[model samples]
Structures are given as structure tokens and as C-alpha cells.
Target chain A: MSADAESRWPAVARDYVQAIADTKLLLGQRYGEWMLKGPNLEDDISGASNGQDEIGQVRQLFRLLEKQGVDRDWLETDREPAEYANAQPLDEEAEAWPTFMVQVALSDRAAWLLLDAIRHEDFTGMVQKMGEDEYFHLEHHDARLETLAVDQPEAVEAALERYFPGILAFIGPATYGAGEDPLVEADFTDRAVAEIRGAFREHYVDLFAGTDVTVPALTDDVPDPDEWDEKRRRSGDGHIDQRVADQLQGVTNREYVIE
Target chain B: MSANTAGTGTAGFSIGPEEDADEFEQELWATVDEVPDPHIPVSLVDMAMIYDIEVDAGEVTVTMTYPCMGCPAYDMIQDDVRAVLRTVRGVTDVTIEVTWDPVWSKDMLTDRAREELRDAGIGL
Candidate 1:
């Protein structure tokens, strides 16, 4: 950590970093659910590959957090559902390809923007490595959107409407009093929520305009901050589905002690 | 002509066999070509990941591309690159730089690699 980070900033920024790390891990878990179950082999390969990329990024962030004195074991395995700091949308099951696409389009891009904001900060090397992965994620999502627009326009539009509000939480509350949030005070993000929301809306519009799909209107899609837990960065009850948890846990059910 | 002191070698070690510049570079590349991709049987050179190789003053730098952007195998591939290339005589330092522009294409694969892929029933 740099002197600027260690000395001048409030402790909340560390929570923010933790939230970002958790979000990446959760997103990787969600993507892992679709590994070989996507609509086609190309999509299957993409899901598997993207899941690996996100997990790789999580490892990098976790290593950084360890350097900053966070406990690695607790972070990886011991946290309760409520203690998880990922965004609410990720808590939902990816039941359909459209739902997954919405996540890739809205939430992933928003997360990418946040990571990109800190690209030149004290964690430049790690952020740059993660950014390289985000580049491919965004590209793959864009390509998938184009495909869905032609094949399943209605489903895509419905997904956009369903998840756009929850995804808005990615940018945080729409407005903040001057010097109110430590995330901004610490220079961790370049834009406030409103600014990011505006830019994201424009980008979202441009993405679907060329096809028959209709982008969801953001006029009344604001997320309720009262529902949001500032510490956990989530707005809903429940963690991941039970099946998902069991599947994840089964990865290393048995281990041998080496003498 | 000079010792490889930049690495873990002990001090005052005698120099190894000498080679002309082109031959030395080819030797480094050959070493690189032998390191297989963890996910695939083919090597980075076979997968079109290696874009260029440069050698100067016993230091080797490789310019590389990912088979796919955000490849999870990035660190492993890079570590393998260093481990393999370091085995070459007279090499002291190894640096691997990644690039994305003009991105990797299947067309860049060597004939042997292409044959391996074809035999495995993998398509471009």
C-alpha cells in the first residue's frame, strides 16, 4: 500500500476493496455454473474460460488483501452469507442464458468500469492484469449480445428490464454530499454514481441500438439504498443457492496430509 | 564470452559455450518452443503466442500474445517461458512482455501444431 492509501484515506475504502474482491469471486462462481450448459459449444467454452479468468483475478485480489493484512482462510471459506460483500444481482441463480447475458452486459461492465477507475493507482500491476481479462469479458459479452439480439430479442429485452435496477447498485447511490463517501475522498473512483450511470446508459444504448432489441429505460430504475447494506454492498437476503454452494464445496472434499 | 551472473549462479563461474548472435537467439527460441501449454499439448510457439524474441547482453526478452484475452494460463505460461528459456546457456535475465493489438490468430500456428489440433478434432 502507498502512503496516500495507508495514511490519508478512511477505513471504508478497505471495505470497498473487500467488496470488489468478493464480487469477483461470486461472479466467477456464477459463471462456473454455466460451464458446459450454455446454448452452444462456443458459449460453453466461453463460460468455462470466463469463469477461470474471474477466479484468476480473485486470486490476485486475495493476494493483495493478504498483503494488506486480511485473513486469507476467512475470506475464502469461513464467511457467512450475510458477511459476503458482492452485489445483490450475483446472489440470484443464473437460471437462463438471458439472465447470464444480462449479468455480463450490465453488472460485469459496471464492475469493469470500477476496476478501470483504479487502473493507475497504487495497485497498478494487479489491476492491469485483471483489466486484460475484463477486456475479453466485455468483448465476449458484446458478441453474445449481438447474437442474442438476432436469435432471442424478446428474452434479451426482458432480462434487461429485470436486472437493470439491481445492476445500478454497481455505481452506488446516485448522489453523494461533497466529501461524504470515503470511496470518492480517497480518489479511488474517478466519477460519482450519477456520472458513471450516465456514461453506462449511453454505452448500453449504443450496444443494442444496431439490433432489434430494445434497451431498458433507466428513468425509474434506481436501486433502493435502504435495501442496500453499505458494509456488504448487497441489497437482498439469501446467499447463493444451496446446490451451488454444495457444488463449490465438493471441489476439495478430501485431502491428504503430507508428511 | 561472459558469465551469467544475473541469475542464481555462484560468483566466478567459468563461461559456457559461445555462439554467434543468431545461433544464440535460435537456441533461446528452441528452448521456448519446447515448453508446452498446460491446457493443450502444443507449445506457446505452436499456439502463436510468441510474437518476437530479442537477446542483448545475455538477457532475453520475449514479446508474447495470449491465445485468448484474459487467459487464465497467463502466469503459468510466463513462468514456463522463463523456466524453459533460462535453461539455454549464456542467458542471464528473462523478461516476458504481453501485447494485445493485432491479436493472435489461428493462422499463426506452425504446421505441426495445426496437425496436432486437426488430429485432435479441434477446429480453428
Candidate 2:
């Protein structure tokens, strides 16, 4: 409502959009890895279905950004890896399926919370449409997580141990009293984040309750954005490192032509 | 057309097929018809995905195809059909043969199946 809040709205929306896109793209890539490797035929089909759903979710978010005057191609392509705010170095080291699943479960839970907040925020008509699609996507992934936890407890436990610590870092810093960025501060409330985190913790506890695995405690030490920036710069120094990009391309079986 | 007529109905129609054979064929067809497509939740018979159901003595053979070659739900439907047929009485063995010939099309769906698709928001 205030001029300061109005000015910050775009940035906050962009951050939220980036977060959603990152989670979708990451999970989409991960699920695609299980295309023919699922435990059974039914599982193989389920994995592909979930992969399609994640890609669909990404497209929905991209459509929302497009309506906000963001160029579709640039939102998807032109941005440098370092400029990807929600992507972190930790994801690269999640080398196994269980590890990847843990990361997906936690990030998806966070995403559902963030999207729920945005759905209620004052926005244009397009945002509401995209929000409804996102609500269904969240439910789909929630069902998937429950199935994996109940049926594949050991795998879920292993993944949780490998990925839970990075979750706190993934939430990024709290923006209280940090110079007003309307998008970050506008319609943002601590209570919403707390509620979202509470829901996440409940699922987390339920999955890990009877297992030998234990997730590390959430930390107050927020990661510095500059550190992530520097890591990206180092990786992009053109040393012919195509590890992550190559891995993603390999899983999709579609070469990254980048045209 | 009389009650004294042998192997003839009251309407003068001849009962060419044996009663036991006719009853077995009917039972076999019903079992195949009852299997539902797991993803679409419609009876395979209504979808016309089932091409033929043949019963030879104690053996039952079902030939079917999916809406498309790459249909993801194809295997699930096949599994359901197999599971349902295994329960049919007097069926000593059941074999499902998936075929693509006479390829499936929207025309294959029964009128009721088309209405079901429309209700589900999947236009014919």
C-alpha cells in the first residue's frame, strides 16, 4: 500500500517465482531419472507421471511471470546460473535417489507454503489462475511424498539424512527490518512462514519417527547470497565443466542444444 | 414352433450352439467386459479397447489395444484385465495379447463412454 511496499512487490514476486521454478525444474529432472528404473512397472509409470506434472507446474509459473511482463524465453534461458536465486551449491552433491527424494520432499513442502501465501496476496487475475494450478500440484506431490514415506521408509530416511540440513539454508534469510523491498516484505508475515515450517516439520517428524535416521536441527545461520554468487562464478570460469548440465541432459536424454 | 420340436425355440429359432458352450462364452465375455481401465476409470468394454474375447474349453484369450502406442496407462489396464479374468469361474488359464492392429480410435468408444469422457473434461 505504501510507495516503499509497492516498489518492492516486483522483487518479492520474482523471488517467489524463482523459488517455485527452481523446485519444479529440480524435481522434474530428478524424477525423470527413474523413467525405467522404478521398482516395478506401476512405479515406472508413476515416476513419469510425476515428472510430467512437475514440468507442467513449471510452465504454469512461467506463464504467470509472462503475464507480469517478464519475457518467457529470458525467464527460462538467458539468466546466468549465478542469478538463479533459489539454486544452491548443495543440490549438486545429492548423488543418489534417496538423497534427491529428501531434497524434493522438503523443497516441495516449502514451495506449497510459499504458494499458499501468494495465492492470498493482492495480485492480478493471472496470479490467481496460476495459484489454483499450483494448489493441485502441491497436493499431487504431497500424495507422492506420503506414498514414498509409507512404502519406502528406508529410502526416505537415507534421503532425509543427506538433505535436511540444506533446507534451512534453502529458506534463505528472514527479511525483518532489512531495507524494505516491497516484493519481499509486502504481504509477507512471520506467522505464515512459521506455519509453513510447522507443517513441514510435522511431515518430517512423521516420516523419520520410527527410523534410525535423524535430521540435523534447523540452523539460524543463513547462507550469504554473495557466497553462492562466488561459487557460481568459479564454476562458470569456462573450465569445460558440464557436470550438472551434462547430468541433467543425460537424464532427460535430450541434449541441451541451448538454441 | 411347437414344444415338441427338438433343438428349436418356441419362436422356431434353431439353437445351433450347445447350451454349455453358449453359457461359457457369455460368462467369458462378461468377465472381459467388467474390467475397468485403471486411469480413465471406464470399463474396457465400453472404451472398445477389447477387440476379442475367445473361450476354448477351459482357456480364455483376450486381445486388446490402447488408445495409442505410447499410452502410459496401457500397462495398468492390461494388469487390471489380467487380474479380473483370473477370477472367472472354470477358467483354467487366461492369456492377454496386446495388439496395435486395427488401431484404437475415438470411434471405438461406445456412446456412453464418449459421454463419460466429456464429463471428465476430456473431449472426444
Candidate 3:
């Protein structure tokens, strides 16, 4: 066999990709929930577009994972809540617009950092294509959060205090599995977890300052690794809510395939 | 970039000098250019998704990109590429490779594609 074919691509590689895919899939569903309930007509429209974009990225990763024998269909529609690898905040709907923007600012940045770290890997090509979209998503939320910072400072602060720590878990455990660091060793991502977390802090701190929102201090933002499931790279349990899942699927009507 | 017609199937393609490869490449590009982006109704060529193309005798290879990372039309686009290219003569095999470098953007769209988007009410 050629060197590339003979190479024993590690199962960890596939697991990491699967984790990324699951995260995007769930994140999309969570965003989709806000399509109607967002603060205004424009927020609703933005939510719908961002939700669809995230799901589209999920479809791409699932297709890639399928080459490694993963079933794309099952990954999309059939999985227990705990089985999903998405960060904890996405497990539940955003309690409010500020909460939603908090997830967007931190959770979306986590995804972007992972993509940035993994850009050099052979299999990350599809994920990299998502950078442009992710950038837009971040900017979209940042703007919304900035507006909230001025109009509803109390709401924005409350959400930061509540969700920032859980959002930190979105970075995954600093180390995972028996000294097997797939993030580095498998070329899945170039940076160490600490480095990523640091960058995350720096990015958000600057973002909050620019938006006139108070940036949460990193000291108080630590995630408890003991609660983290390294395999799934998630900090807490529970999948998407079932009722929300039905709404995301829009199962009642499937008359025509979307163009 | 070189093509040798001496063989058939996967082994049919042969590599040679650079100068001799241009005509074959152009022909293959033209053939696959007919494939359209299912969602947009614009040719993949116009969308700049066909990043690279290689032809060796009866075997043809194409590298393509999606409009976005998780574009739902990915499979359909690839199938269209393979289906269209296979219709070209002296091409018994088809290979489609996906790449993400220089990710797709509005700027990548050809003038014709931009015009179509404009007609469709998408802001430039």
C-alpha cells in the first residue's frame, strides 16, 4: 500500500471530528430555537440564518466522518442527549437574548479556536471552510451583545456570571485519555488547551471592552474538569430538549426538499 | 498534467511533459464545467469551486470546494461533477477530491455568477 494508505490513522482522529460535528449539530439546533422568540424581527432573522449555517457545517463534517464508517443519518437524528459531544450551554435553550449572545460569544469562539488550531491537519479542510461563516457568526453576536451592554447591562452581566464558566468547559479538558493528547499528537489542533483557554480569555476580554460590557475574570471562570467527559469533550450532561428537537426537525411537514 | 492514451481504466492515465498537458486539461475543465451548483443554479466553474483538475488518458481527477463547510448540497454537487465529467470521451474513471484552502467567498464568484446572484436579489 502507498504510505498514505498504509498509515494507521488513529481512531482518536475520527472521535475528535465526530465530537466537532456533534457540537455543531447541537449548537445549530439550539440557535434554531431562538428563531421566533428573539428580541425582535431582525434578531429572529439572524437566528434563523445562523442556525441554518451551523447545521450546514454539521452536515459537511458528518459527510467526512462517514468515510471512516460513521453513519451520517444516525449522527444527525439518533443520539441520546448524553451521547452528544457539544458543550453544556448548548444542551439547553438560551434563557434570554443576553444568554444567547453569551453562548455565541464564548461557545462560538471555542469552535473557532479549535478550527484555527486544526487548520493544518489533512482532514480539517472541510472544517476550515467554515471559518468565514464562523467569523460572521461571532461578529453578529458581538454586535448584539454590545447593544445589550448599553440597553440591558444587568441582563448581560447576569448571563456572563451564569454561563461563562460552563462556556469555559466548551474548551474540553486540559488533557484527555491516557496521556493521549489527540489535540496535539494527532495533529487535530496545534495549540495546548491552556494556550487555547488563554487566547479565549484574551479575545473575549477585548470583545467585552469594545462592547462596553464587563469581561468576567478568568480566575472565577474555571471549569471543574472532574465533571468533564473528556471522551465527549463536554463539561456536563443532557442532550437537546426533546420538544426543541421536534421543533428543529419541523417533523410535521416535509413536503418539499429545500433548495 | 500529462496524459498517455496507451492504457485503460485506472492505469490508463500517464504523466508526461507539461506542454503536452494543456489541451487535455482544458477539455476536461470544459466537460466538468457543465455541472451546476444545485442550490444556486450557477455552474461550479462560475462559482470557482473546481480548484484543480488532472487528466491521464481515460482517468480524470478533479478537486472541488463547497460554498460553505456544511453546505447541504455537497453530495449533490459532487455527484453532479462526477456525472458530468464521465460523459466526456476518453474518460473512463473519475475522482473527486475536496479542498478547503482559500475558502469560497462572494469574491470568488465569476461575473456571470455575480450577475445571477444580483438577479436573484442577493446584495452584491
Candidate 4:
């Protein structure tokens, strides 16, 4: 970052941005791992394309934070698993196709909700461009969701139960509003945490309307702000998957990037 | 300046507005516009990828965006822009800034570009 630009950056800028980028980075990892494992060629292609988009988004987001004094290299490769601000749904690999679908859908929606909120005030133009790419991702998720909910409703429900609470905790308790988050105070996003969470809940109200699955209400317990670590979002020593973190650190082939 | 494929002898593609741009800036456009997009047959300028081009002395700053968010061509496009622009006379430095604002869409395609794409059997 230029010295003048660095001087202009506020102190409370990096956490929210890092949280969104980190979540998308892990979500992208899951997509890449399953790109070829999907049941069909088209599904595999969707996974590959969406996964590539996520990596691109992570780069753009990190570049944004770089202006605020965060080192892109440190943010990408050096952070320990606990230093990551990704949502809990991405803590482990998905063992089943249906489970992966629900997990990805929720995780992607949470990230998008954050992006959509920032689009209103975005000056970098990256946010609006990312929203365009995310539009197709959401479409793909909905179509897969419909089929998965009908074919394996039980698995879908189980996956939803597994992931929804983590997202709630990420958004904080149901009482979240502008007063609770520094993001709102910084004007990085136009919506309060609760409003963003509500927008997320509304996404599933009718997603399974015609399917065998019954969508449940988001009654998950929210994290208490008093004990929360705003930078990491979640309040635990819990870390991301070690295997994934190693891949990021390039314990594998040098050709692979942290994305 | 290298006399490679910087200028493909393509037709006029001077920037639409900003008539006040210096002669060097205008020359920079024609030079950089010659580099074809990796995924498309048309030049970058015709594809509406060149958002802004400003020239101060010999230094040039070009703000551009791509049609797809994840297209790996972004890296190539940056390199190509630099290579082509640097080959231009009086050009000493080149800077490329990628933006996603007003995201690239079919509406941004030039008429000539649309025609070329149509001839290529690529749906817009």
C-alpha cells in the first residue's frame, strides 16, 4: 500500500474483510476437492468453475485488505489454522455429496450476504463484479439443492442441521444489530449483523417448498459477543482442517496455490 | 522499443471520449489495442477491456477489467498490456489496475467486436 493510502486506512478495517475472504477460501478448497468427485460431468464443471471464482475472489479481497496494512503473503500462507476467520461449516471435509451441497450452499450464502451488504457502499468496484459471478454460483446451488433435497431429504436435513448453527454463531446471536458490529460502524457494510442473518434465513424459506424435505427454522444458538473474538469470529481454539492448512502452506506440489 | 506484434495494423480504435488526452496517450491506445485477448479473437480495446488510459510524461496507467471473474487470462492480459504498451515510442513505464466495477457484460462489446464474435459462431 502507498504511504498516503496507509495513513488513510482506519484501524477497524481488516477483520470483517479477512473473515469474508477466509471463509470463501475454505469454501473454494472444498469445491476443488470435490470438483472431479461429483456424480456427473456438469456438476464437476460447476464445481471447478465456482471454485476458480472463489480463488479469484479471495485474491481481490486480500488486495482490498492490503491497502489497510495487511500483508497479502502473511494473510494467505503464514496464518495458523486458529488465525483463520472462516465459518465453522468448513472446519472439516464433506463426506457425502448431499452433505457437501448443503454445507456449500450455507457457506456461500453467508459470504454473499456479506458481499451484498458491502455492494451498497463499495468503491473498489470489485464487490459488484464479484456479485455478478456469485449470482451464477447461487443459481447452481439452488438447482442442486432442489434435486438433493428430493432424492436424499434425510441427508440434506442432517447437513443443514450440521452447518446452520455455525453460520448463526458466525453472525453472532439473534440480537445482532449495527451497535454490535464494528463493520456497521466502519460503514463497510450497510446492514446490521442481524439484518444480514435474516436475509440469509429468508434464502431457505422456500428453497425446498416442492421437495420431500422440510426446511427448518434457524433456531440455532448465537454466540455471545462478550466472549467473542471479532477478528476470528468464533470463540474457540478450534482451527481449520490441518490437512487443508498444510496444502495452503504448500506441503504438496509447488504448482498448487493457497487458494 | 521492440517492433514485435504491438501494432497489428488494426483499424482505428482511439478511445471514445477524453479527446484532451495527449498524443502519447492516443498512441498508447493504438499500441496496446493490438494485443488480442487470450480467449477471444478481438483486440482488448474492441472487447471494451480498456477502461481508462492516462499518460503523464512517459508513464502510463491503464485501468481495465475482464469479462469473467475467475478467468486465468487476467494474468496474461496484464502481461500483454505491459508488453505492448512498453513497445510504444515515448512510453517508459506501464501500470495496470484491474477493477470489476460496472462488470463487463454483452452491452460493453463494441459493434465491430459483436460482429467478429458472431462470425466466430460464439454467442454473445
Candidate 5:
């Protein structure tokens, strides 16, 4: 790689790490909502453990970002929500537990595919380390899904209809520029959206195979890019979405303002 | 005078193997195993958290320990055990004695419990 390309590499890595970390932190916070309220004791315990795993992954990724001289507060502090580049699909709201479970199953499965691809990428050690954590998370979520599907089939079906579209949105746009301004420059060797979607679809099909739950078809086309941008902008107060903000209200019971 | 002094009464208690008492003791213990561990959500029997169960007449006592001394869920687990035991057919009253004498070790976990922990990525 040329000097310019080499210079670009760290930036690439930083952007990729930031985006992934943001996604993990956001989803982890969302999952944590189920800690005490899951439909059953087993599901509650599993959800808590899964949330812990995601937090662990976030911590590791944040540490790497810190080494790159990113301010710790930028990663940890409640910031303007618009800066959170988490894919919109993962951002959809679910009004019930079943819908929430479906949302989690789909998003977590997609995340596994994305992480697996990045893990094998020719990159610095940080991505690889983060990859290991994602593997554990993937397994954890999948196990919970299996338990739910076998033990409570009706709930799984209900969730699939309510949240599957959100899962599709989570794979993100077919082309970064096709939707919102590319949050970060696409750097991975496997940059094609179709390829990524196909991989995600394969995993989804296999997960639901032989089960009563029917895998919902992916949305035929990406949401209009302009509409997506408008949705993104209207998402919430500066750093996190309204839904998350509402969920996390009084989280620490202290007002936080960046100096 | 010596005869008069020997006339002072002596008090003694007699003890024997009470079969019903033994049966009750075993029954009480069997009930304790049905209680689930709050943190792991597994039966106390499977987790081996129930170290001993003793019964004396109507009063049942259980000796138990948690996965660790500072386990945050210790109180909840104790409450769960008490609740479960209170529902047993014969248990009139229940008491749990939380102890640290034989500290809980991973070795105490059943094969299935170990597998669950491993599946969760928690290494022993």
C-alpha cells in the first residue's frame, strides 16, 4: 500500500471500530432493558448475561478507540444522538416482548455475519480481538433464540412479524451513499451490499429452518435515501434516540453535561 | 447422713433413633432440592448449593452456600429457597442457614451445569 493508502488505513480502522462499537453499545443498552422483565425466569437470566457480553465487547472496542486518541468521553458520554451511526433497522421500536425477541434474533444474527467478515479482514489486532467477543455474543443470542423458539413458539412467531423489517434495515443500505451520507468510508474487501445481504439471508434461513417460524422476506428495496436521512435526523436528542433516551431516563439519576 | 445426701435426685435425658424423625428429615431435604438458585436459575440440587438439610420435628433447616461470598444474588436465592420450601406438603416451617464453611467451587457444579456455563462462555 502507498503512503497515502497507509495513512488512510488507520482512519479506516478507526471509523470502522467506532461504528461497530456504537452499534454494540446501543444494542447492548437495548438488550439490558430485558434484564428483569423477560417473559420467563430462564429468558430473563439469559438476556442479562447476553447484555453483559455486549457491554464487555463495547468496553474492549472503546479501549482500542482510546488508544487511537479518541476522547473517552466521546465514546462514553451521552452525546448528540445524530452522531450514533447505528444502522436504522436496529433502531425500530417493538411494543411487546415477542416483537423484541424477534428484533434481537434478527439483529444479532446479522451482527454475527458482519463481525465474522471483519474478523478475517487484514487489519490490526483490535478488530480480531473484538471479533472473538462478537463470536461469544452471537452464540449467546442464538442459544437464547433456540430456547425461546422451542419453549415458546407463539412468542417467536409474533416477534418475527413485528421486527423482521427492522432486521433488514440493520444490514443497512445496498450502498453506503445510497442512503444517508456514508457514515464511514467503506473499507472492507467485501463491500458489496448484495453480498452482505445474501450472507445475512443465508444465516437467517438456516436459523429458522425446520422451525415453525417462517422467515420474513427482506424488504424489496432500501428505504429512499432522502427519507432515511430525514428519519435519522429526527431520531432523537443529540446523542441517542428518543426511544433509548426514554428507556434510559433516570439511568444514573444524575444530569450529565459535557464540559 | 450419707443416705439422705444420696437421696438427692438426678435428672437425665434418654435418646433413641426416632424412625419418623429420620423420615421427616429426609423428606424435608428432598423438598429443598426443588428450590432453584436465583442467579443460575437451576435447581439447588443440580447446582449442589444445598449442602445439608436437617429436620427436627416440625422445624426444617437447610444449610446452603452461594457461588461466592459477595454474590449479589445471595439474598434473592435465599428468598427463593424459602418460598419454594414453604410450599412443600409437609413443611410447616423452614429455615435456611447460609454458610461459607465449605466454600462453593466450580467442581460442585453438575456436568450439565458446567456445560451451561461453558456455553455461556464462563470458564471454570
Candidate 6:
């Protein structure tokens, strides 16, 4: 992290953007793991395509953060685990296909919601393009969710219970209803964390309602956001996966790099 | 050189507001148009990927964009752009910059490119 970046952006802007980028980076890493491992050919190809889209979006966000004086290299690597602001759920690998789909569906929607709120002068175009890319991603995930509704309903429900609750906390539950978040006060984001979380919750609730799976009605504050860490933007436990840390280190093609 | 000879008619691809292309500019545009995208069958110019080409004295700068932010072959495309631009005469130095200010859309494709895509079994 550059000292200049710290001074260049308001704390809210820096924290908000970095967390989004970091989470997407980890999500992209998770997607890459499924490139050749998805159950079918279409899933395999879609996984690769979505993975590339995530990385591509990450690249764009990093470029923007770079212009704001954040060191692109540092953002990619060199930060400690706790220093990472990614959603905690991204810290783990999805063990099965349904779990992966559920995780992706939730993560992608959360990302889109945050990105939608953060759109400003220059970001307006990028956010719109991302919406286009995300449309297919969410569609694919929703299709998978419907299929899993019949095939692996239990797994899907478990994933929803496990992951969905943590997202708001990941996105900073501390800012929820605690008056206006600094980002909103600074006009960096159009919506408060509360509005974004509310939309996310409403979307999943309606989506789950349509599914045949008889899961409990989506609950709010499941993990209890009272312990949400303002700085880490999470519930104050866990860290990103080690493999993700290696990726953040940008350690591609070990044989190619000179010692 | 087949691509350049096949279509000397620069119907749609042109720089700035000037629809007219001088002989040298046409050659440079043709040089770029001939370098095929790794994924697509049509030339970059046919695909309308070349946004603008500015030539001043002996130096040239080519500004362009990929269809998506996450194009896996962007490096290859950029390198190919540099190599082809260097081959053109009156180009002493070459600079390439990719921008996302106006994100790429299918609307950016030319009529010829669209036809080629359809022929190649690609949808608009």
C-alpha cells in the first residue's frame, strides 16, 4: 500500500474499492479452479469464461485504484491475510458443483449490487458493461440453482444458509443503520450498505421462493452483525485461502520467473 | 498480403472524422486490418477493433480495444498490432494503448465483419 494512496482517497473510498477488488480477485481464483473440473463441458467452458470476466473486471478496478495512487502490485500481492478485505466466504473452496453455483450466484449478485451503487462519472460505463457480463453469469447460476433444486436440494440449501448470511457482514454490517456511512456522506456511493444488503436479501428471498426447495425463509442478521469489524469489513474471524494468497502474490508460471 | 489485396476497399474503417484515406494511411490501415484476431476469423479492422490510428512524422500510435475486458489473447493482439505497424513504411516508432472509455459492443462491428461472423457461424 502506498502512503500516497492512503492520503489520495478518503478512507471510505479506499476501503470500499479495495474490498470489492479483493473479493472479486478471490472469486476469480475460485472460478479458475473449476475451469476443467466443472461436471460438464458447458459448465467447464462457462467457468473459464466467467473466471476470465472476473479477472478482467479485477484488472479494470485495479487500474482505477492505481490511478488513485494505490500500488497495483501491492493490491495484487504483498498484503497479509487479515489485511485482505474480501468476503470471508470466498476464503474457502466450493467442494461440489451445486455449492459452487450457489456461492457464485450469491457472490456475483453482491458484487453487482456494490458496483451498481458505486457508479460515478467515469465508472458509469464500466458498471454498465459489468452488468451486461453479469447478466449471463447470474442466468447460468440461476439455471444451475433450479437444477440443483431437484438434484441436490440439500446441498444448495446448506450453501445458501452458510454463505448468504455472511455477505452483508463482509460488505460492512457495521455501517448498517448506524447513520450514514462515510462513503455515502462523501458521495462515493449512492446507497448505504443497508440498501445494498436489503436488495441482496430481497433478490435471494424471491429467487428461493420460486425454487421447489423448501428451505427456511431467508433470515436477516443470521451470523449476528453486532461483532462485524468495521476495518476488515467482516465478522472478525477467518482469512482468505492460502492458494488465493499465492494468486494475490501473482505467482503464475514459476518456471518463467527469474530468481 | 491476401487480405490487403482481397479488400483494397476500406469501406467502413477510417480514422477521425475524415472518411477519405490517403495512400499511406490506407496502407497502414490495411497492415493492421490484415493481422487476424486469434479468436475471430476476420481482421481487426473488419471487426472494427481499431478505434483510431494517428501518424505524425515517422511515429504512429494505434488505439484499440478487445471485445471484453477479460480477453485472454489481448497480449498476443497487442504484440501483433505493434509488429504489423512497424512493418509499414513512414512509421519510425509505434505506440499502442487500449482504452475502455467507450466499452466495445457488437455495434462497433462493420457490415463486412458482421457478414463474415455470420458466415463463420458466429452470432451478432
- In terms of DockQ, which candidate is strongest? 4
**Candidate 3 clashes between residue pairs 3 or more apart in a chain or in different chains:** A56-B70, A57-B70, A81-A239, B13-B56
Report the number of the highest-TM-score candidate.
Answer: 4
Report per-prediction Cα RMSD to one decimal: 9.8, 19.6, 7.6, 6.9, 21.2, 7.4
lDDT of 6 at B33: 82
Tens-digit per-residue lDDT, A1-259, candidate 1: 2365344334565666777777777788878777877889988787777788887767666655665678886777665666667766787776889778887657778776666655224454445556667777789898888888888888888888877776676566665323554566666665555666777788878888878778766542365656655666556665666555544444355354232
In the range A1-259, model 3's lDDT, one tens digit per residue, is 1245234446766676666666677678777767898878988888787887888777667766776677765665555556677766677777777878887666777876765666333444445457657767888887887788888888888887877676666675544332444657765556666667777878767766755567777652266666766657655565677665555545454455473
lDDT of 3 at A78: 57
Instruction: Score residue A195 of candidate 1 by CA lDDT.
Output: 62
Ranking, lDDT, top scorer first: 4, 6, 1, 3, 5, 2
For B35-83, candidate 2 gives per-residue lDDT tens digits of 7777675688887777677777778788675554335565567778778
Residues A50-102, candidate 4: write the lDDT tens digits: 99999889877787677667887688778777788898888888999999998
Q: Residue A132 lDDT in model 6?
A: 66
Q: All models, DockQ values?
A: 0.05, 0.01, 0.22, 0.26, 0.01, 0.19
Off by over 4 Å in 6: A1-9, A36-39, A77-79, A177-179, A210-232, A247-252, A257-259, B1-31, B53-62, B83-97, B115-124
Model 4 interface CAPRI class: acceptable
Candidate 2 pairs with clashing backbones: A8-A182, A8-A183, A9-A183, A12-A183
The global C-alpha lDDT for each of the candidates, from Candidate 1 onward, is: 0.68, 0.55, 0.67, 0.76, 0.57, 0.73
lDDT of 1 by residue, B1-99 (tens): 011011232233211112444778777777888888787778777877786788889888887766554466778788889988888889999987654
Model 6 lDDT per residue over B1-124, tens place? 1110112234554533246767777788888988997897999887767888877887888878677878888778988989988887778998875555455667767788889999999987
Worst 10 residues of 6 chain B by lDDT: B1-10
What's the TM-score of chain B for every model shown? 0.79, 0.74, 0.76, 0.83, 0.66, 0.82
Q: What is the lDDT of residue A218 in candidate 6?
A: 37
Task: Name the weakest run of 10 consecutive residues (lDDT summed) in model 5 chain B.
Answer: B1-10
Q: How many steric overlaps are in each model, in order?
A: 0, 4, 4, 0, 6, 0
- Location of the lowest summed lDDT over 10 successive residues in candidate 5 chain A: A229-238
Error of 2 at A134 (Å): 7.3
